[model samples]
Target: MTCTLENHRAELASLLKPVFDSLGTQWLPVTSEQLCDRITSEDTFAVLPIPAFTNSQMDGYAVRSADLLSAAPDAPVSLPLGFTAAAGDPQLELQPGTASPVMTGAMIPAGADTVIPVEESATGTFPELVRCGHGTPSGQAAFTAPSPEGRFIRPAGVDLAAGALVAPAGTRLAPAMIAALASSGLTEIPVRRALKVALCTTGDELSNGQLAEGQIPDANSPMLAALLRRHQVEVRTIQLPDDPQGFVAAIDELQAEVDLIVTVGGISAGAYEVVRQALSPLGGNFHHVAIQPGGPQGYAQLGDATVLCFPGNPVSALLSAELFLVPLLREFNGLPEPRPGHYPLAAEASSPEHKHQVRRALIRDGQVTILDPGSHLVHDLARADALVHIPVGVTQLVAGQSIETWSMNV
Candidate 1:
């Protein structure tokens, strides 16, 4: 049966959902330092409270609130200053009717319930003390204003409490989440293992080295490989000729080593279709999808791997990978789906009457201008930052008309 673009995507999701679900059950421990872009396999909790203890939020004087209750500009309260408390210093006890200098992030001492920033004191800075009796420095801090209890004091667990949820299962860890995890004293995290893929590009005219007449460099393999890697799929690429037996042998060798097999070219109806000829007898379903640039598509279950086939043109192959395969890999890796947005057309455009057409476009000055729609326009595809999707039955679009678009920046 001929499938619409939406139907094809839904079918692919249904076929691959179970495979990814099974893979999610397996996980490995990764260091917190290296957990960026990794998905959590299970809910993780903080081992310790963020900050671990009550500390000062500024460079100030730690004092008992009661000591400055009656102080004012006309009648300032002068109290002897004790030891200076800098960050990493051991906790010290506050003496009665005295203040202690405390830098930002310094642990608040016992009996100190409030902090007064250095600028709020009479000197506008910490007092320079001179050695006095008992080898302790002697000085005094004069306060003219009263600060309420708990002011400028960052209490323990103020950011995150011990045993609180750091991240939930299936969360893709970002940089901020990694910092939070590290602050919680967690050295390791449990993350899902990455999915593996085998990428095969087939054509007799494709070559990576010096080319002769009618020979072109293999562009699909590198393009697809980069896209797959960006979604955390470990990829191994192989270039194959128009020989059906060689393609079949390659699939046999890769079936046990990869979770998916993606082939570009050789699936369309032609004199030298290699992928379809080799995989059709193994239950592959090759058909036309109702989408331009990437209409000829195929999928199959071969041995222990799922196979996907795309058209030969550079633009067609890249568009197919973005539309069909990228979403599946992102979902499997717990990354957010690339949602489509609506934008106004910069100029008039037309699409096929029955096929959903995707044209390269650029968003400039808040409007999207459609580029060339040819499937072989590889250079035009590079200048596009968005995919303007004109659905089936949308034959004509006037200027200033809003159309659905998927961002290519991600």
Candidate 2:
């Protein structure tokens, strides 16, 4: 039966849910540098506090708050400065009645409860060192204002405490999260293994190189491969001829090795529709989906693997992957679903009465300008950064009318 685009997605979800669940989880150990965009397979904990130790948040003086209590603009108090504490310096104890020069991120010495930024000091910078009676370099730091306790100090565990949850299971690690995890002394992380897919593009007229007369260079294979790779899916490309028997043989050989098999081309009602011809006898459901550019869609189960078939046109295959396949793939991979954004139309547009028209468009200046609506317009598709969705029964759209768009660059 012909299904609407929404119904097709729901059906695909229901059919593939078990196949994905049966695949189970495989975890890999990865370093913080390799963790970006990887989904956490298990709960991760902080090995140490984020700061690990109290540190100065500014290049200034670390002093006891009581020492600055009497200092004011009219009655500035000067105290001898002790050792300089730069980042990576060993922690030391602050002597009474003396201020310690501490750089930003420097460990705050014991007994110091406040930091006075160098800019706020009387000299507006660190004082020069001189020899003192004890043979240690010393300098004077004058404060004109009292510093409250803990001012400009990043206390231990202020950002994250020891043994705290760093990232929970199913969390997609971004760069900032990786930084936090690395700062907590985590050297290795557990991330879910990438989903494995076999990308098959079938058509006798398609060639990868040196196309002869009546043959076209295969765009669907590479295009779909890139889309799959963007989602971190491990894809193995298989180019099949229009011969149905040969197609079945190729699929049978790879079905056991992959979690899902995605085929582009040869799924329509044409005479050479190898994908539909080969898989339909094996219980594949091939039907038209109520969507422009991509109407012919099919799915079948081949033993442990599930198959998803798209039309032959480049634009149709691309939109099919974006709308139907990518979302489900992201869902199973623990990634967030791509949310649709609404933008005003830059110009007037129209759609058919029965099928949702998914037109390529350029979104700029908060407006979406629809491009050529033809399914064969690969050049136009290349220039598009978004897909503007005009639903069924909406025949016309006026300029400045807000419409839903899905970013193609995502």
Candidate 3:
């Protein structure tokens, strides 16, 4: 039956709590090579990293750090150049009393401990007969100091200690996550199975989408389907007419197959409110919610499944979905209720009673502003980038107040 806003929210929360709490998630072990879809339980796959030592961080001479402490720009120290280590080679040990020219990312030789940038010393004119250098020229050793060599070469495991939490259970893996996971030696993970949903649209006129002789097209059902899908919900659809018995039979038939049932229209006090009438026979009652253009919302058990009913108007249908369905999705998926975010109101507007108002608005200059006239203009809701929630009792919103909006594509 219809109830206060608070009651409806409470009812919804209760019905949804078990879905999140008892999801009883399962995992199927699969090879890392098989990981594909973004929603798989991240724990199901593990990766085995292909490890190899590679290129340098930069090019410079590698030496022992203790060797450079006394060297200065004025009276520089000098040593014989040993074999050069290029970017990708294995470590090249320095001969006794010699410095090795090394590229970035190269492994340090067993004996060398540091690197000094090339800018610190001059190449000193190429000599046909190179001098046997030690602690600077022996004659110059009396005058020159030694330069430090330890700062340049990065020690092994500096960037990553072994066995890190690259991608733990429940991780949402991306390229970087994959790289990290592979690096940490994993190949598979276990994840939760997806929940299945079915959409049953009521009213023949709405389905036809033909505006003939006061008839209306069925916009709400399809729109609702799209919204659910955007949230990664598994959904399918069926349509019904304005006959209570037939609709009830259909609900009876489908309840065993889906986790939830959502219907659009025919919940109001009107005579042809077949969805309400149909659900009423199966443990539910159709009643008016104390809200707005969509106040005529309904809910009840449709056999084993809970049915969320929305007003027939397109805006009302979508608004109802936003207010009720999205939150349920979050709970069912074992995720926290989304934090409500806000942007400035585009323009000031007023509504009747203590109803929560939703209007068409887009994000402009980092703020939410009205996109169209503040009309209950049902169709206009489709154009909205966000929903501006007017709080209870205010009855009016002055422009520029940073009202809360639940993003549409979230």
Q: In terms of TM-score, how similar is model 2 to the real structure? A: 0.86
* Candidate 2 wrong stretches, greater than 4 Å: 22-34, 66-78, 129-135, 144-146, 333-352, 362-372, 394-404
TM-score of each: 0.90, 0.86, 0.67
Judging by TM-score against the true structure, name the best candidate.
Answer: 1
What's the CA RMSD of model 1 in angstroms?
Answer: 2.9
For candidate 2, the per-residue lDDT at 85 reads 85
Candidate 1 whole-model C-alpha lDDT, 0 to 1: 0.86
Clashes of 3: 29
Clashes of 1: 0
Full candidate order by TM-score, most accurate first = 1, 2, 3
Over 4 Å off, model 3:
24-56, 59-112, 117-160, 166-187, 207-218, 240-257, 302-304, 330-348, 360-379, 391-410
Q: Over the stretch 318-391, how does candidate 3's per-residue lDDT look in tens digits?
A: 77787777776754444455566777776777765556555566787877775543334755666667766555
- C-alpha lDDT of all candidate models, in order: 0.86, 0.86, 0.63
lDDT of 3: 0.63
Clashes of each: 0, 0, 29
Question: Of 1 and 3, which scores higher on lDDT?
Answer: 1
